[model samples]
Target: MKEEMINIQDPILQLKDVSISYSPGKNAVKNIYADIAKNKITAIMGPSGCGKSTLLRAINRMHELYPDIKIMGEILLDGKNILKMNPMEVRRMAGMVFQRPNPFPTMSIFDNVIAGYKLNGISLSKSEKEEIVERCLTNVGLWNEVKDSLYKKGTFLSGGQQQRLCIARALALKPDVLLMDEPTSALDPIATNRIEELLLDLKQEFTIVIVTHNMSQAARISDYSMFMYLGELVEYDTTQTMFTNPKDKRTNEYLSGQFG
Candidate 1:
């Protein structure tokens, strides 16, 4: 049977000839063009140094924080050029979670969740802050476990809990897109499973773009998959199709363990 094609109208974000370079004459990500569907989980997969994470960071302009990095082409979020928007606003709309759980050590559990607002100088009333804390924590499945100790330091929680706290922090902004860079790579099996479950549920509300090295994790959670190699995107298709029958030789080899 022939596979159904992805419709152009379904995309929430589109990358057009996107490329990134960390230094002169060296492109980390080269000429990537793809559409990310709304409210679906999209995984970017490749071996280390293949530019999966670089492309993920460029989605929200995270590379701008560094002086040496430069990006080319347009990354449109809902048809608006994200690079032209204010960096902070862009980040708020497309929040990120890193490889490690990086809850602020100096802040309490409650503060960590609302840190984005505070850092941005957005003042909230006591009641408003409380509402956000509860809502975001609950969103990440951490409210029940941490509610009693909301005032404790963020570092007080276990590794999994800290990761959840970081996720809660991002969710508090109510982002349109959530970008995760190997979010569960540092986690243990149980913790990773929990995060995977959380991501599955999250796709119902937000468009999720994740960079993952774990092939099985991508196969299990992503609705669409992009396979990159040596700074180039080799294939982008439905996860089932990409895994079962990739059109590109590189993608097939990578999936078959012949090369990465």
Candidate 2:
């Protein structure tokens, strides 16, 4: 298993000339091309409605949520096209955490984290599931806060804690890739810093692709950055390079606030 993992490709995910359209004539993403680095943070930054969220959703096949939307082009994970896999299997392979802290309002904190396993039909012994809950919560730095109140409703927690619970839920699936769409956008500065710190630690175990409108967050957390404009990727480079000296004028303009 170690040998096979080592021999694998550098990109955990590859988007080859992909284009996405919601309807017959409405193209949300056009001629998009990019790769997500393995075990590192790849930041996707662009103006709102420039297909930023749409492009991130495509990685885990979340575009399938919209029946009217259609995707063309290959999205490869470990050199295999994701389109060939079942939507459920693909989602399990790449877990997603949304922009909001959306822990189930009715479920307990313990139930929320391991909900993925129960919902996905993956079986584990009672103690094993308990362990998964503890481990995942600890991994996301929420264990200490909620350890004693694991049985309490998820929504009873603060907004930041709810978001972290959602993260723990995704992590429970043991996904190879974790996609975060503006995970910190709604949180306070302290909460945002904690999430950023956790993300830096998470990439040690799994690939991370993040979409953030915050340029400072992107510069601080990402190993690499890809800039998209008008539904096209304009620059893909090391985070340092992209933030310091971008190759594309559009990227530079966007970064400098000349235009979005």
Candidate 3:
């Protein structure tokens, strides 16, 4: 394991009594409230469809892409309601990485990384853009592999490389928060380990919230953990306590693999 690099002092984003539904009648994430430790990783774990990803998607306002989804309650990012902000604006502040690696297949690697700045209507000079891409790639632990062939098609890269490229794309925007949904579930153990290392390095500069089914991965990398069950937050606690001595019996049972 790597030595600590994150400054986990205060809460960066806090969800205040939040409830989200796919439609007016169907609940996906319900009364789920949590405080994300600043400059640290907070992993959300639960059974499938238990609102783990739903809660994370809500944080970045991705659910709004679906017309039927309606989010209620306050999501305070630095103490502001994220739902009230513009959808694009919210996403910019909190970048997302989905389950599958989703680099633009047709775009060149360099162009794929610069996609955020180009699409966001933000302008940067050639030198500045190059520097941004290089720095972000380095941050995501991919610079050494792609620094020379950056102009080649992004899809030419391996699956792990593609995932890290997507991470670099997110980092290029220099977002304050990074939300990941099953980021390593698709990769081999070796690739997954690399991503976990990259994430450990990343939290020194960004807040990270991950939805993961791998309890061992969550225990290995996260500073804090939140347990969800049936669309509700059952408990939130430090990783050490959550794994070693959870106060809630439900958390204990779930972590022990009795029932998830």
Find the candidate with the highest TM-score and give its number.
1
Between the candidate structures 1 and 2, which one is better when assessed by TM-score?
A: 1
What's the ranking of the predictions by lDDT, best on top? 1, 3, 2
Steric clashes per prediction: 0, 0, 0
- In order of appearance, the predictions have TM-scores of 0.96, 0.95, 0.95
- Clashes by residue pair, model 3: none
Residue-level lDDT of model 3, residues 145-185, one tens digit each, is 98999999999988888999999999888888999999999
The lDDT per prediction is 0.91, 0.87, 0.88
Top candidate, metric lDDT: 1
- Model 1 lDDT-worst window of ten: 1-10
RMSD of 1: 2.9
Better of 1 and 2 by lDDT: 1
Could you tell me how far off, in angstroms, the CA of residue 107 lies in candidate 1 after the best superposition? 0.4
The TM-score, computed over Cα atoms with residue i paired to residue i, of candidate 2 is 0.95
Least well predicted 10-residue stretch by lDDT in candidate 2: 1-10
